[model samples]
Target: MEGIDAQRLEVKKERAPKLPVHIAKEVTKGRLLKHVEISEKSVLPTALDMYREKVDENLKGEIKTHDTSKLRHAEVVEKNVLPTSVDIAREKVPTLIVNFDTEKLKHVDPVVKIALPSVNDVVREQEEFKAGANEKGGMIHN
Candidate 1:
């Protein structure tokens, strides 16, 4: 094209897709931007956060790590907190026993509507399902 002017000769550069113009913003949209200092620092994505999120989401309560807190200036008790079964068996050292008065309860035998089978039956079942009764292998063949 010989008649084309200098202005026409210059190719128009396409605007870099205009970042796909986001119209609808979230409720917490500009709130995060207020906290971030764009000039001073480069803010990372929300996926890379400080808090370690629990992936498993345990239904049961949190597992206790430290049983007892290490007190700096707290009064330490010299006495044993918990007693062993042997200590419980012996009545020599009298301990604090909080017992509820069951005087209101009638001294009547509780009738079992559904009685569970005895431990003996469970043991018999275990014996039947023994891994190596015949000394064959860890697992029973039949």
Candidate 2:
């Protein structure tokens, strides 16, 4: 310690442990600096701005009151429009007389008796017509 000069005293720095020769050889080489470029202007980190909108509301109302009063009125009128004389009219009508000869009318029959064909009779007549038409060789639509 006495042989060492004061100005020649050396200071030592702490270092991590050394890696094995095989691991050191396996490490890949990299570039010292990246290829990206930066501008002169810089941005600061700040909170975003909050915006608020204002709304206007309006209210209106109306009130009404009424007063009523009664009023009285009177009016009179006079006129001379009567006639001096008046005439009456009378009419005569003759009476009507009818004589009924029911005795002669009872002997004459106004309504004659008529017989209508029943369903069976009508069907039989249609069948006969069809047979006659077929014998006459005339074409009849169904």
Candidate 3:
């Protein structure tokens, strides 16, 4: 019998690995210096001096003697404005109820029923987990 001829195996080609992206260094100090230079050049020194003078004049005018007696009288008036009877009446008044459509009421039902776990629930679960772990003598994985 003639010897069978063997076929040459073809090699599979692979995609090349992607190269890392290059980022340029940020200009921090240079940008800050440029901003400062622009602000200095944009404003006139004389105008800035005039502004400072006006601000000082305004500040001087604003400093005046406050009448403590008048302030005390005003505070007394404000404190005494509310009557005890009015407060009692306000407390006795029931809250006003606004009725809405049945469909709107139904929409609010699920939002109200979403059973948000309370503080007690969270504490109870945590204690249960700790107790279970202690009993097993190992940390709970889940």
Candidate 4:
């Protein structure tokens, strides 16, 4: 490994990752870490002086991705790809397959005429007309 001088590293004050303003001004002097902590292990910082500019580009890319996702979500709503009011109404209220309009609904004809027996017919049909009241007040017919 080649030895790198820390004194030669340059500070980029304009485009550092968003940090609290109350931090020490000296802390801002050396933007690149001498040894960065990553995955529980300390690693050497990059010699690149333009780190802040690269980070700004990354942030811009993320912003563009977020905006694109929002546009795709809007497209799903604007197009009929997602279920709409009409689709929901049609699903809820189904159309009747049997049409009553312009077509006669055949009425079920009821039994209008039934043969009823008269008093003469009932008396003539009876072979034995003997009827008397029994001891229990119920009539017995023969």
Write down the TM-score of every candidate. 0.18, 0.22, 0.21, 0.18
Query: Relative to the unseen true structure, what is the C-alpha lDDT of residue 29 in candidate 1, on a scale of 0 to 100?
Result: 66
For model 2, how big is the CA root-mean-square deviation? 34.2
Candidate 1 lDDT over 32-135, as tens digits, reads 44455557677864653433334333422344443355636778879867987887768644442335456767888878798788999988887876844646
Q: Which stretches of candidate 1 lie over 4 Å from their true place?
A: 2-115, 131-135, 139-142
Q: What is the lDDT of residue 49 in candidate 4?
A: 43
* Candidate models: Cα lDDT each: 0.56, 0.54, 0.60, 0.62
Best by TM-score: 2
Candidate 1: worst-modelled 10 consecutive residues by lDDT: 12-21
In terms of lDDT, the best-performing candidate is: 4
lDDT of 3 by residue, 73-112 (tens): 3344445565699787676666323333455454444455
Residue 134 local lDDT, model 3: 88
lDDT for 80 (candidate 4):
53
- Alpha-carbon error at 14 in model 4, in Å? 89
Clashes of each: 0, 0, 0, 0
- Model 2, range 69-140, lDDT digits (tens) per residue? 333565767887855343211111122113444565546658988999999999999999999999999999
**lDDT per residue, candidate 4, 24-82, as tens digits?**
55476776537776677677667574697788899999887785544643344455578
Model 1 has an lDDT value of: 0.56
lDDT of 4 at 54: 89
Error of 3 at 4 (Å): 29
Question: CA lDDT of 52 in candidate 1?
Answer: 32
| Local error of candidate 4 at residue 8 (angstroms) | 94
